[model samples]
Target chain A: MENQAQRSPKRRISKDHWTAIAFLIPSFILILVFVYGFIGWTGYVSLSNYNSLVPDFSFAGLKNYIYLFNDFRFQADLRNTVFFTILFIGLVIVLGMGLAILIDQKLKGESIFRNILLFPMALSFIVTGVVWQWLLNPSTGFNQFLSVFGIQPKWYTDTTILAGFEWGSIEFGLPVAIIAVVIAAVWQMTGFSLAMYLAGLRGIPEELREAARMDGASEFQVYLKVVLPMLMPITMSVVIIMAHISLKIFDLIYAMTGSGANFVTDVPGVYMFETTFRGNYYANGAAIAIIMLLLVAIFIVPYLWSSRKGDK
Target chain B: MAAFPIGKLIKYIILIFFAIIFIMPIYVILVTSLKPLDEVSLATMWTLPSAIDFSSYVEAFSKLAPNFMNSIYLVVPATLLSALLGAMNGYVLSKWKFKGANTIFTIILFGMFIPYQSILIPLIQFLRTIDLYNTIPGLVLVHVVYGLPITTLMFRNFYASIPDSMIESAKIDGASFLGIFRHIIIPLSITGFVVVAIWQFTNIWNEFLFAVTITTSDQQPVMVALQNLSGSQIVQWNVQMAGALLAALPTLLVYIFAGKYFVRGLLAGSVKG
Candidate 1:
């Protein structure tokens, strides 16, 4: 009887553990089918000759990828994505870290300034796109203000490449029109980095800074040397987060400026959407998506792996 | 030396300058939306409206109301289901601590960073096969499934702060799995629920790529409809501005009210899980 009593509790505990795992099973299966399984399916579609209205699962090898590389629009997309990612990530970090440090100074009306900067994060990228489209309209909006200083730049409508050089079917230098889209994107996303850096800043101990000050470090040096290094992890998180968003950016560019005149603002997201849905070039679209996924995975895989390892 | 803090003055000046530039869009949106269409030309872009008008808002609201309702229907259910599932998964992952839990979690977290375009082709095929394409429920399922990673990440981190000893004591008291979850985890993680819900609500509400591709007219969400507002041949800048505000209103309101929770969600979603 006593033996039965002890084993009963153990059996019951095991039963409860089974239930715990059972609850997780449904989500696990859904993610497998939806996330992982669908990715495999996409890979298959990318490899097939599925380029028409009807499904064509016949093998085409790397023809779609080769076509994209040689194509003018897709080449432009690759260039635009590279420049946009670099400029957007760079500006967001500088601007975000700057605002974070300024706010950490604990000035009067700190919350108000923080709220104003962060409110844009709440608004949709579509709204940001639409509103900025007007605000930066070549002939109107900010141009009206800037005209007082005798300058009016055609923002998104400008088709000029800033430092032009031919590398492939298109210019491989910065596209001036992309700057307009970048401005709106930076405005919307800087708040995320700011919040992250601010959180990181707050988590840091005051004693560390006090110790630096006692050692005769200037405020700027203290932040540059002591604080900035400490915020490196947060910076990594921000870069990865922003890099992924920048890589797949569509709505903002779509609504703000559709592929510019020379496909200057086009990225893979826009290309994939247009070619697949509008043009019905399914295989090509799948290829673009796979490329985008690969680009994002380059940053994400390492980050996720390291973080997971760190957790253990 | 200057008696005044010149450093403080420079700081305020710099902050205010950026603040003005940052809020310029809002100012333009407000000013333009209140003006008559004739008064909304490029020449008068920076000027405040000669008179406040609600006509654009009336037009925008009429066009957007149905779609706004679609967003609400999509967001509420998706947020709830995802948050609930996240809480359940989080409970098991954090307190249960079975083998391979971290690996499973890392696999799931990868989903959060993936470009949705990668999965678009097959996802559409699967949805169409199930006859859920072009429906709000389909969008709901998409949001919930995709939302799982972040929501799970958030809830797991939230629950991690909760000590394991509590669960041990409850186990000692002979509470079963469901009983412990029902009586213990739920009540303790109410704030976690709020954070996760707010995050999911904002994301699903503001999401464009899915809303645009998945559903068509009449079933479209407000963001898609607002995007369509500018597609009309004769672009009414006033109406466009008003529609932008209307579409953004729900999330802006959430940020305004529950901003603390919203920021907490932001931190939780991004920082190491």
Candidate 2:
């Protein structure tokens, strides 16, 4: 292809070039105002005294942030978010990658299995929450099946903090009830990692695996030593994507189980919604939103930067 | 190769087990929705309904029908507008690249990963200021704006695969910017359009945070109404399950029929980003 610079004189513009800018201007402006501008406004609100229903944008200087750090519910939300993000991302990787490898084996009825795993990805998180709420109900749902084995556990309703120890007016351990939410989340989202890994696996040439086999690597070792290493980038992408989702998760937990007893399942997303909308604590909500954005940015900014650099 | 058979058996066992776990909720939804209230209980949770009951469907449809229409109204135009804007921006970014294009693209892409909470306070306030609050148009605008990042990313990646040689040759032939887009780029990007449209449709249809907060009561979408159904005082498992199915039906149908494009959209959205 001819170089683009070769066709046009240095620093001279064309009508088409101006038209292209015009085409992009609207979306550029919208994103600039809505995303960047809104974030700035929310940040300002977080620092202001805007806790009441009526707008109060007076400067409060980190009062909301300080209060959240010391608040019981917010403390629990932080703990829950940490546990949820770790468990959710871990399970999604293991299950999704495992399922992807199995499906990549050229087995009979492969598409059928793949479809079953992926169909849930199409449904709304709200629907998943509603359906799973019933399916995991402690007294009436999966417990009945578990009862056949003489074991039943209270699912989401359980507020028990496993390995409980006091920290900041809340337990500094995994809330057992969170396991139920994690199960539903993993089920809905594992399909994403599966699809991603499947695409990555397909991109890897068969000759590479053949070469590994020739090196006396067994089938398991071929995957462990040869394949899994090659799929690292895909894993990185999945982790970042799932991390963002797990961090901002609201609809699923809201629909399936509201902040459970003792706020075990309360995430920043849920807390933000209830505080801001339900309770009219706008500044507090904005603080939560800012924190959520920061947590997500920790994963996303570096990922976006490196990916753009990679594109070059 | 003597161990191959056992390995294969174990793979099948594991795959089948997870598959069952994945499909279990659907089975529960179906069985519970079809059962009479008397039979929808802990003891019979896993059992098939004694008689197929359509009353839950009637009730759920009647309750969710209006909000269901609200979602349809919101999704259709939001999907179209976002896809069109994305295509234009993508064409500019990929084919008509100027300096700092990558930086601008990166900035725009950041919007996609943001927790919507960060913008919710201001978004609602802005909507109210503009008199679009609690209206379907308000939701549509929100979806379109937020939807731009992913749609733009998808279309940019899609258009990137189209060789620059084609655009360069077309420009040499005196084809104007819109001319090339109209004559060549648009025609070649039907599949790109499909993937992005289906993605936007599904996302806007299934979105909840914006739906629940922006619109309340009658103006709310199906998902919020469905949540309300379950959250209401007297819990009706049958109706709740039926409502879940009803709310999920459109995207479910889209997945069943055009799932290939949907999956393509999924991979395009995540992998390319």
How many clashes does each candidate structure show, in the order listed?
Answer: 0, 0
For candidate 1, the TM-score of chain A alone versus the native chain A is 0.95
lDDT of each: 0.92, 0.93
lDDT (Cα, tens digit) per residue for candidate 1, span B1-273: 758688988988888888988999999999999998778787888898888889999999998999999999999999999999999999999888666899999988888999999999999898899999999999999999999999989999999998877887898899999999999999999999999999999999999999999999988999999999876657588899999999999999999999999999999999975
Q: Tens digit of lDDT per residue, candidate 2, span A128-230?
A: 9998888888888888888889988988988888887999899899898899999999999998899999999999999999999999999889999989999
Query: Once superposed on the true structure, which residue ranges of model 2 sit more than 4 Å away at CA?
Result: A4-11, B1-4
After TM-score superposition, the amount by which residue A289's alpha carbon in candidate 2 deviates from its true location, in angstroms, is: 0.7
Q: What TM-score, over all chains together, does every model reach?
A: 0.97, 0.98
lDDT of 2 by residue, B154-196 (tens): 9999999999999989988999999999999999999999999
DockQ scores for all predicted structures: 0.85, 0.88
Pairs clashing in candidate 1?
none
Worst lDDT run of 10 residues, candidate 1 chain B, spans B229-238
Would you give me the overall lDDT of model 1? 0.92
